[model samples]
Target: MATRRKEYRFRNGKIIEIEENHDGNYGAPGQKRIKKKKPTEEQMRLVNINNKVKRCRHKLLEYFNAGDCFGTWTYSQANRPPDMKAALKDFQKTIRIVRIEYKKRNRELFWIRNIERGTKGAWHIHFVVNEIGDTASIMQKAWKKGGIYAVEIRNEPKVYDEDFSKLAAYMTKDEHTKEIKKDGTPAKPRLKETSYNTSRNMPLKKPHVDKLVRWKNEVKPRKGYYIISIHEGINPVTGFKYRRYTMVRFPEPKRKVQLKRRI
Candidate 1:
């Protein structure tokens, strides 16, 4: 009765999340509430980054698939952005040009981007944009202030079981390093805020919620769907077992053509 499972179905794959409801009546209405220990700053930071990465990965799975562009834009020392705001402005300028190019061809561009400033003050942008032909060329022309490295999201993945998980993790990584300030004092490690920007045309995916009256441990994929990744974990709060996995259905093979009889 306390178990809830959610299924997010995407074009190429699906994600499953199972959790135990912790809203049960642990105390009576009149009982004084006991204050719980606050989570440390580092713990909170990690949780936020994890949630952002998960959300971004699901969105990637929902709208974009193989052949989409995964790109990194870096600035030269001369043209590097002076601040995070300037970096964002530069990204906007580039995307605006890209959108116009797509519009000229009677198409709309959907993109997700994350910008980060390194500890050494180097600013860069990581983006995943839907490719509708001429994507790489368009990117190269649009972002003139920096070096652009764009590659198609491969249909076959060498590291992860699925295609986009590794890419998503790499793009949303919260890289940080310790450093000493010019004043001979320790400085806060620059943490890449786990956030992303999206084009207005991006789709908001909603998952189907299922309440499992009878819990089943066995997971079986539907016909034509193959399980690619499986993860099992226990909730520290409830001590309940929860598990999730992804199922991907490959494109069906094309039917062979037959030659007409000579007679």
Candidate 2:
């Protein structure tokens, strides 16, 4: 007994808004506080897994670009000279070739710098260049080009794995893994950030070569940041001798500009 139009009529026997039908939504006139229903356990798990996959993919791609050889760099304090800017520029110039080669070989290089402390204790960048083979040679060239004695050494490294399935599988079905509400329908899993950080082989600690000295007000300005005037132990690897002058323990805040981005 119903016609084509009647078949789509509302229960109240009124024709539904043509626009609402096309849009799949009725423009409700009143304010309605629609509380987002909490996701079921399975939904949450799926979301978490999805997030995990995203993070892993991101990191894997980053590693691929940087060649998975990321680490902080350090040079001998004794090798530091009167000027610090000159040293970094020289080193950068030497490193430029490595960058070029990475592109030539279709590899990626990612450099990250954390709380720099080189010849001048300035912020230094750490990178994971795409090509792994030429690191030693590049460092040697940087040393020669930099003309600075502080050796270029990598420290505190972390590598990313490309195999996403294996990397993702680790978080499967673990109750401890947290989840996020995904944007799309029936939100799929997205891995938690904490889980990713833990599993990605990320370095838990940073290289801290705090040159401490006990010079009473004798702290003098060196290359870039003011030097604490260290009077101490030689590095086992480099075998460079630091002047026995005691370093001034400047408060942590001032240390950055006062003694950052050195070597």
Candidate 3:
């Protein structure tokens, strides 16, 4: 017996030839199986950066509720900003020193370092740090790598009045896009490092699913925890849609004891 084959042509001028398998299934041999496309370097970079940004946002929201202050620290020089490698080195040393100094206060400091280009086309570091005492002085004193300029620390407004999403967006704006250097070279290819850095003290968020019915209902206040924000989106990795409810757990409330009266 001779097996019949069929050839199909598409509008794109492409042809697909299919033959019957031994089991009588019609396909191009193993065509019934689905193959996943591998992501390119650029695509991988974008995905990584996006995930980092999301994690940062979640952490920021959590830390802010704990009364942590937010501020920015910049590194610059008279000639130009320090190179990425040198700037990162200085940042690491600065964080180490800051931790040691703040150890006495028993407070944890969280930071995210963003590398950006200044108006003068110089590479500089724009760092966002959680509340720490005398942060400007500590960072300025630690950064001695040269081109040391003023380290400005500006307090962020109240969390309720501010849009936290902008923080992540600002840090990662145009990060995935390709840029051209003054020398007519692609800057993206040269950027082999991450766009941002975070402190090890920062906690990771574990999101839980919420009932779809509660989408429009106000979140109820619990005794030891409260809802910070709710976000709904499709998971890129798993391709599953989910509604995430972010909650901040706090210390247990102190209970009042009543003395019993004797009859």
Tens digits of per-residue lDDT for model 2, 109-179: 54432123332243233333333666555544545422221222223222232222233333222334333
Better of 1 and 2 by lDDT: 1
By lDDT, rank the candidates, best first. Answer: 1, 3, 2
Model 3 clashing residue pairs (backbone): none
Model 3: per-residue Cα lDDT over 1-263, one tens digit each: 11222222111111111212121222234466333456677667767776666666655554443334344454445534346676566667767887787776787777776665544555655556655657656666665544433332223432222325556655554434455689997675323333476777766534322222112324353455455455455534333333434344565579999999999
Q: Give candidate 3's whole-model lDDT.
A: 0.49
RMSD of 3: 15.2
Best by lDDT: 1
Regions of model 3 farther than 4 Å from truth: 1-46, 61-66, 75-79, 104-106, 118-120, 140-164, 172-174, 177-194, 203-228, 233-242, 247-263
- lDDT of prediction 2: 0.35
TM values, all candidates:
0.76, 0.27, 0.52
* Positional deviation of residue 244's Cα in model 1 after best superposition, in angstroms: 1.6
